[model samples]
Target: MNTENRGAAQPPEPARGAGPGPAGAAPLVDPLAAVRAERDPAVDVYLTGTVFLDIIFTGLDSAPVRGTESWARGMGSSPGGVANMATALARLGLRTSLAAAFGDDHYGEYCWDALAQGEGIDLTPSRTVPGWHSPVTVSMAYEGERTMVSHGHEPPPGTAPPTPRCPPRTRAAVAALTPGEPAAWIAQAARLGTRIFADTGWDDTGRWDLAALPDLRYCEAFLPNAEEAMRYTGTDCPRAAAHALAERVPMAVVTLGADGAYAVDGGTGEAAEVPAIEVAALDPTGAGDVFVAGFVTGTLAGWPLADRLAFAGLTAALSVQEFGGSLSAPGWTEIAAWWRHVQRYDDQNPAALRRYAFLDGLLPGAGARSWPLRRAVPTIGFGRGT
Candidate 1:
């Protein structure tokens, strides 16, 4: 088995009674006591999947010619997959943790450092294998489109180690997986009594065994994009595909890029098409992952299916308006404000609204011509609008 250590250094403790203590008393306590006390029992949203370093190069008009190069307007490293989802959840004030594998290399260290600084993220379970290099994806974004080349190592053999000690308040977990690892992880997650949300990764190609579907039978929700749903169900129509999945799983959701998403309640035979949030596309890199994050967050917050889809769609729409994947994602407060202002506009005011509401009649409580209004908002250094 590949082995590598990529753990982040623990933060330094403050001096005794340096600030305020319980009742402002200079109470004596063990240094590790605070760390132990901070162990949140809240069911952490477990993001089990791949974490990659995204190297994005922008500023091309179309696909590059062989040996030809284009200047990159911007470039940076950001989290990918489960790491990105966990980051989004933490940003939304959910206590989250990541359970995944990274190579024992600088990239792995980078991932550890990046995630360690985020609020509500616990990264104790990330394993580093010695012979593997952390996955990396390099993409070029031009004219709002992107083409990418990725390299990911195979997972080491052996089951993941048991979870670290957690506070009793853990609430939910979302696990993203390729077909190779789905059955075992899904069964394990279901047995834990944790609300399990899952999405298909790139490995769910035609070769995947349909028998594995039974393993996911107990999942609270199963998410797959249009292409994945089509491949999995052997159908091009998303609604039909969703129905096929619902026949096996409890709930199935198929996200249609630019068209919105289709969800079905297996028990009630109820389905709804949540309209996509209209926004000018920049680079549609991590929009789907962001959508999953939004949906899971909404689920944990007890939101109805309609609102859940709305949150998911809105978050995805916003993600493409910027360059990086999770870097482009908006926080809960930002999304809430955007949704209230952009989606809830006055339908009667022709001059005030933007166009692109093709699903007005198709979705419930929707109006015609719902376009996003772009205003010059001040950007903080951290991608937040002030």
Candidate 2:
């Protein structure tokens, strides 16, 4: 798709509750009318915020001691956060675009190349900082766990570049923020008639004001990992944290590393518990980003909530099997096939399978649900059961 003409077509109108609308008639305009008035394009996904260059170093036995040097078996660079999600979505056959800032440095160029050439993601409105340092993360993987050390400051504000050539069927916008200008960016996307999905970065914890929650309340989904949820909602339990967040947002999902995830609609009491995909995790760097990509893609494709969770879980499981973030991300074809096979075999024990399916769907595909079946298909080579 052409990146130049995408978001440059027209200016967005004021959203319904921005201020007073049409006189005494309630002041607020009808949301449906506004949606219809906007040209609902075929843009599959708009990803904004948290674009970074991730340098992954794999196969470490322990943290680097003061003077000791560890053998670095593997190293590679890939897109991080929202950028990673955009690329994953594009690889899964979605029309995706990225809106973020990058420095004019070599690191920024590397990030741009990964998103553009490597994943075919469009970068229309992405800004380039003339003399700024682009964000970078150094991730170290040991056993199955990983730790990240980040560098660089947030990108400076500037007029967004023209939109690129994108698909016309615009569906959802995923915003990954590290506590910088999230409210304004989110509002802008919302004005364009796109649903918003939010993910908080580790650095955003104490940096941004929580009061911004009210402004972000209109978001369709709010995704935060277990620790971030606890920090944001002031709770220890993932479910409680999700509930706290849901009180302000429409929907909330808290990802619990190996435990899985829990989602709830603050508007309703409905909730779903998803389990983690069981895999011999090689690296956990971009697992959450992959999960967000899969979930958003499934949701935009009209998959049921259960199916969405399943897809997200499966994608994350596949991601851990490889070293770099995007390298291990599975395509839609792989995810669909795995889901179908798991469903077929799960039919054996009706009652037990139903509950297992519900829990497994939470983990990605049936990585955890297919544990016992692993012995049946040893060639697939998923690790021992969870």
Candidate 3:
């Protein structure tokens, strides 16, 4: 439980052999272990990308046809994309920062206020672009999958967002790995000693650009979903694609929707895989982003590959079971609650729950009474101006 070594991303050590675990099992470490784990993190993670005010419509059985209107059983809006990831990270008690542009409009103000007040996410580097409308995404959740349509206008003259600077204590970053983002941005971040975790979009052209590979080498991890991974590697198998992509970076993660996820670590030549948690998925939106957030958190926490993958999958599962995209990512309180419930109910799957055994050490005695459950989605709060 001694975490004096800041630079070591070592695997989690064996159980301390003491009073009880974080979730009420046998003793693992001292009661202050969670506090110690949270201490002195310069900046846990920095995220950069388009932050959107997502308008999500869920509980629809199918998409509306061109000539007809549709009815949704549920609807709500929260942050999406980078905003979603940042909110997820912050909810995990990580000191999270976001560098993105916002418009000088109501949507923009709403997003800024929500992220700053609701999530306690850092926005010092985030700017307001006047005379521009904040990006808005319309997400339709149906049949366990979500379709998103986003709209954003070019910012007014000279309203471009500033270049991102990696803070001295910033340990990790999440950024888009696409042609729109310059390689130098990542290079500069790397020079500052920040680990970059990159993600890319699906290739519509079907020609996975080999030209982009060299530029992505600066990243520590490249995460792409199963279809994208297969398209880029020319392999139908996700595991094969992950291994192939690992050749380009230190870590390659291929996310398979229901099958779970697969990872290959280049430094250790270690391969690990975790199955998706079995649960009724209400909305699949933001599940991938939540998984990435979990992966980054686990990596920053120095968890091993297997534990990281399992934790990532668990977070994703928790996200899909709820309504909104970013709003659905569970925090430590939810994890602790689930753990206690499983123990109380004597869940059938002992081995499966053990994958989350990592949660025990996260909170020493699991005194979640002090920690409030943080929800990301909201319609109105006490702060609405009269």
Candidate 4:
């Protein structure tokens, strides 16, 4: 593929004085500009799922004890769940649209504004139900892992999940496949020619049956972690599981947490693997979602299979170094900065750096944002008077 004009162009570098400041100041450089130039103006990616108000507690040396009260050194608040992926795609300039239920409470209002206005995601298909309370998740990050406690009420009787009867016509959509329940919109969107990329949560029922995931037939790609892939395919190796899964889907991507990711193109009988970048992770929340967003961006831009895997791993690597899930996702500026920063170290491997050289033509100039962009603050509300 000719990558020169694939539309991954980024914004011009900032001026000398324009160092990284606030998060919202920079305009997002669309990675899909080139592709969209020749295509219709339909939404780039559409998704539907539950949204949660996430309160993250970080800077912990170990997991909280069973009885003692633990005080975390740092904390942040953001919209999570499907909102993480939605924000990630929108920040990458994918023209993302989301359809999900929201409570009419303060948390719902904040999440709605954050995604719709802050991240430039389309929420026209999303609705807020009266008297319904938004779901909430409290995450505590320690030792590169996290423990979460979530709470929410089932919507009042007769209230359905916010899936539209007729989903929008988009280039692609992300689906979370449940074992027993099938999402009708997945098949609906596929019939309309929308490429589907799906990922599944842990099956609590312990029946990792591939037949249970009926929506796989419509998915263009299925992304599952190493454990999930192995369980579902009944294979010991994740790579073998990817091959087994490719028999049902056009492509299969299996993420190996620390080892990086592997992908197989069933259509071409080709495969690619990329090693994960080492970073001091503060929170792992939403890292998987960010990885999927990156892969979708690269795939939609017609990049090579290897380049797509590298980009996906790179984005997820960057996301873990931050505080919150949705807001922690890096933009073009951050990707550009990381590329430039790594080149300055003498110990860096040339071959490793070369893997990400595709970013050379797509990143911002010398004025790219500084490494470690500003993160979300702990509080969600502000004082009436400054």
Candidate 5:
């Protein structure tokens, strides 16, 4: 997006004359300093919506036919949806908790274990609903895109129990508002002064309900991808669509897949856009969710909006290079490690370094370069060098 900055060995500052952009922050000199946050129970982020056992199939040859069979070279089963966002938040070192109903079935146990133990996410407020089968999503990834089919059963009214109480101190939540799903809880959370970061799922019926606009007033932030924003605002332009949606909420962030992202901060009456980090995407399944995770992390840290968007873009870019949905999210370890790896290369090769130039200003110092050398080198003796 900003090639000059991308290849200049330092990330660019928010351009001054950029049309209708948010106020600028100096180019992030040390990203860690720009985003210094802590684990505060009173201001932590809460993730909701039931977990799904994402059975991801990758390296597919072609789309499966109606009466034909297909095969994928790789497959991985991991947490999806809420877990996707939750894991990404935890990986970003955020104080995160999840509140949702889960099935007592095998899939439920798998997801619970993955989120609670594997990702170190707080699940104390989440419960398992008996007899309700766990949600399962079968994702087929090919050519940098994913096709997902999910199955779940929603208990009828009076039968379905309420979501377990979220952490008493939660300050924010990530949830979707569909037709039949609860909207009252959003108001309840709002009453508690929780900053709700809301997003909507795809509307298959093509009826982008205008009534839902009122529901968003309860949320502090509304994040939707370009297509979703366009569909809701009835405007194909991402910028106009973002400003249009900004009218209904405090902040409207429209995530443009490759074109990066656009946002309007109603609080400051400022709108800014940032470009996406270029990467060879392997599986883009949960990139959007990860982007939100980074954005929320930046918001909680009080970072500049431009920095938030850039960090989010980087997070999503790293995610696409890996396969599974939630499992693919990069932790701080990866970020720091890559920052060091990129520094070894010369700035003279700007085109080659452009991809990593942003890290120069963000990561603190040249992180530990390599592991300590061991006296005894273990070699299987496959080659003469051993």
Candidate 6:
């Protein structure tokens, strides 16, 4: 296992010489430009978690057979785990800072460079541990689902440079709440006036008690899937679950897979829902992370609850059409292209198009990159040069 430490220094300027680094990369148009404040937070979003090197195999007809050799038609690899959400936020033009550990091995070096240089994420708070091998997850995707097997051990105790006691003061932070294991930094960041948006993984313990998550009180919004919201709230319907959850947090967003998402604002008793966009899904790896990033962007820009839901759903829908987790995240260029493409379809429902008509004023001028921007190569190790 790798150990991580935080530093007070700011992110270094992007390196100059590189085949595809942050240097000279055109900045995406900021969706929040109109709301820019003279005293804006130094960072738009801040998050800390484990980073995993994800190896994904796609284009499989079904789950692997027990006694036979199975082959996948396609494969891709990239930084994953918390990196998924970090990359998603960065791609959407949010100033994202990530605090995590990286192994000293080749995989770790590749992952670090990919995030810091390629994605332009701030890593001053991150550290590298000597002799630690990067954790890895082998994922198989088929039928819009995925099965993953991961392996890694925690860093032995007494390692140099422990986790940071205080995180940077950012506009917002995303926390993954786990039962019985509270993150101390969540409360600290909250006290510093950072809006907290949180999500949860499946509770394998079968105990969905809301009491287990003591840090929920500090959060401004809580996003959980349909099943998770229903289980935690003991509600028969997802919309009801959202309402129940809203009583705990100011806002509750419930994601219903193909049906899209529903959200409720307890502060104002506002409710909104958006249908999912139809597209051929190549991989559903980082769609959830993308969804949260979109919502955060809209929220920080002061968008309405309904528009937030719609934008979140639209971003997730676009991510499923690609492969990998972090690399599959779409940028503003992709969003602009999709908006233009849909506008050409005159037969489409006017209401549906009007729902997203707001993008017309927010989108940047046409960029040089083509639609469906070509993503990074499936695997690392093409020599660090290019």
lDDT string for model 2 (154-246, tens) is: 544443343333322366777655554445656666666678887877754564455645446647898898888888777878899998888
Once fitted onto the true fold, the runs of candidate 5 whose alpha carbons sit more than 4 angstroms away are 1-43, 155-161, 164-167, 179-182, 347-386
lDDT per residue (tens digit) for residues 308-327 in model 6: 99999998998888888888
Clashing pairs in 6: none
Give the C-alpha miss distance for residue 124 in model 2, angstroms. 1.8
The candidate maximizing TM-score is 6
What ranking emerges by lDDT with the best candidate at the front? Answer: 6, 4, 3, 5, 2, 1
Candidate topping lDDT? 6
Candidate 5, residues 229-314: lDDT per residue as tens digits? 89888997988988988888889999988889989998787987777767777678788888998888777667778767877887
In the order shown, the candidates' Cα RMSDs to the true structure are 9.8, 12.1, 8.3, 7.0, 12.1, 3.1
Question: lDDT value for candidate 5?
Answer: 0.67
* Model 4 alpha-carbon drift over 4 Å, by segment: 1-24, 37-39, 158-162, 365-367, 376-378
Checking candidate 5 for backbone clashes, the offending pairs are none
Provide the TM-score for each candidate, comma-separated.
Answer: 0.74, 0.71, 0.84, 0.91, 0.78, 0.93
Model 2 local distance difference test score: 0.63
Q: Cα lDDT of all candidates, in order? A: 0.62, 0.63, 0.71, 0.82, 0.67, 0.83
TM-score of 5: 0.78
CA displacement after TM-score superposition, residue 143 of candidate 2 (Å): 2.8
| Model 3, residue 305: C-alpha shift (Å) | 0.9
- Report residue 126 deviation for candidate 5 (angstroms): 1.4
Error of 1 at 147 (Å): 1.9
